[model samples]
Target: MNRELQPLLDEWAREAGVPGASVGILHDGEESLLTTGVSSVDTGQAVEPGTLFMIGSTSKTFTAAAVLALVEDGVLDLDEPVAKYLPELRLADPVARDTITTRHLLTHSAGFLGDVDIASGWGSDALAAAAARFDELPQVFGVGEVFSYSNSGFLLAGRVAEVVSGLGYEDLVRERLLEPLDMTDSWFLPWDVLTRPHAVGHVLRDGKSEVAHDIGLTRSLNPGGGLWSTAADQLRWARFLLTGQAKDAPPLSDATRALWRTPQRAAACPIEQIALGWMVTRHGDAEIVRHGGNVSNLQLSDFITVPAENFAVTVLTNGVGGGVLGPKVVDWCLENLAGLPALEAKPVVPTDPAEYAGSFPTGDLGFEFTVRDGGLWARMVATDGTIETPPAFEVAFVAEDVVARAADTRRPLARFLRDEHGEVSAVEFGLRTAQRERSRLTA
Candidate 1:
């Protein structure tokens, strides 16, 4: 199988133009690791099995797990309001600030602006400082209104754990989570990662690969999307999730695993529901819980697990093209190794395409939907000049209110949200909500 996979991985990486890539798979009590390309184009160092790559938001699982560990230790409750721990918490909406809980944060339904990026300095107080500025974040919806991903909510959740455990977020995770599971290759700091064989993230410039200007995430957002890990280490993390058994890790109660498996909220197709830190999808009777990660537009990762099949796979890459490569690799592994075929989402054309055409703006990111050629077209806009704008592409409704790329419907691109009078009021994209730009709406 390694012999067959090596050439395929090599071909995929070359086609995707990623500088470095690694894959790990665990199936039926056996495991395999595969690597291709150099860790850095400048250094020309071969990617080793243990070379570290940023796992991005995939670290959210670790954050959620660390909080759960606290729950097992009788230090916290998921259902309790976050204000119980951070008494000084403030937000633009008092009701949401007061009612949001760890569960709400875990499930990405905290209702505040999810895309706010607070860059508190590199210190043990970073998460605390980031959570302190919540008053500036606008309320996108009422509490528990819908499923909009919130990195801010996760940062606050970590702050809750920090307050209760009397330890910093990184220290708590290192001591209670990674160290216990024997995941020694994982690190949360730049200095720590520099000491190991690590991959540098890359971006394409004029069709040429260039090192990304900024590769590290802010210390404040560490709880939301900051962790450097190897493919081998990620497989070990998945094993712990599979059986709740690890080298020195404490046992999670049956109820805790049930919470991890239970469907907390309904989501669009391709994602049947959202579980605790995992996206839950159904293929036949198998429950596929998975998550993908992106780091500053430089690195991309995909992690998947099937508990019933006792199978898991992870792909890590040092280039943005991994966005395309990672999913292709996962789908292949699922069908060949786990006998689970990937589901293809068919387009559902709405009766009126104009109903979804408008400008949805949120924070630094926005989307413009226009009616063209009797179909709906969409493109991403950068409102604050913090991001690069991309060209428009054709998209179609895949569900009653969901819009995805017409070329690939495997993942939802956005969901059109309606108001009390059933008028489109906002759009949920990249798991964040953007209110309609009524003044700039295209008729």
Candidate 2:
């Protein structure tokens, strides 16, 4: 299997301009790990089997899983208002503060601005301190009104875990999830990772891959996306998700595992549904539960699995554009390794592409869509000076009111949302609903 995957990994890493990457696969009751390229452009270090790469939001699954374990232990209830656990917790909106549930947090439907990142401190009170600052985060939509990805929500969930268990979030996860799965190489702190072989993140600037900022994630965000793990450890995690058994770790009951993959709310196109901690989708005849993570344009990671087939694949890359390599590799693995054929989209030229043209703002970044060359194109605009904006890229309607980048239709970029009058009012991009600014601009 490595013979078949190594060449593809090498070729795809080069094509994606990623410095280094590691691929892990669980196939037909066996496992395979393949790696390619240097860990960093400057250091020229080879990526080894145990080299750790930050898993980013993929850590959310473990956070959600830990919350679910607490639920099963009768320590907490999923539907209970989060205010029950953290009575002092406050949001910018009063109602949301009182009514948001742990379930809402797991499904990312808690509905405030989901992108808030606060570095409270390296102390044990980090999670709680960071969450306390959430009063400044304005509510973008009503509680559970729609599916918007919330890193903030997970931090709250982690804090709840900390409070209820009387253990720190990292300790709770290590005891409840990671240790059981035998993911011993995965670490959440920078100090822990720095002592081991780890991959440094890289970013592409002016067509050259350069080493990115190496300071690890803030302690407060660990529950959301701060995991540093190896490909083998990630594959072990995938195996546990696939079969829910670890020789040394207590198993999460079958019922709880099923609930984790159960659809909690409807998401936009490409993503069919949002489960407790997993994104559910159907590609061809297989149901795929997966998640992808990016750390501020530094590292990229993807984890995908087909439960019915007991097949899983994880791709960990060390560069910004490296994420593109994941879908390509997954497509190949599904076809050749898992025997599932690819599903191609047959998109059409919309009659009035102008209807989708407008400026849609979400937090610090926004997108300006325009009609050009008989199609819709979008340029990412920075709403705040902190954001790095990208050039305009063409997109196509893969489904009604949904657009994906023209180059990769399988990855939906934004889904248009209509108000009561049946006109486009906003867009759900990156899982956050961005209200549209009216305009008749054409490029």
Best lDDT among the predictions, by candidate number = 2
lDDT of each: 0.83, 0.84
lDDT of 2 by residue, 218-300 (tens): 78988889899998998888888888868585558888888888998898545779998899988788899999788876788
How many angstroms is residue 174 displaced in model 1 relative to the true structure, after the best TM-score fit? 1.0
Find the candidate with the highest TM-score and give its number: 2
lDDT of 2 at 415: 82
Each prediction's TM-score versus the true structure:
0.92, 0.95
Tens digit per residue, CA lDDT, model 1, 116-149: 6788888878999899999999988788887877
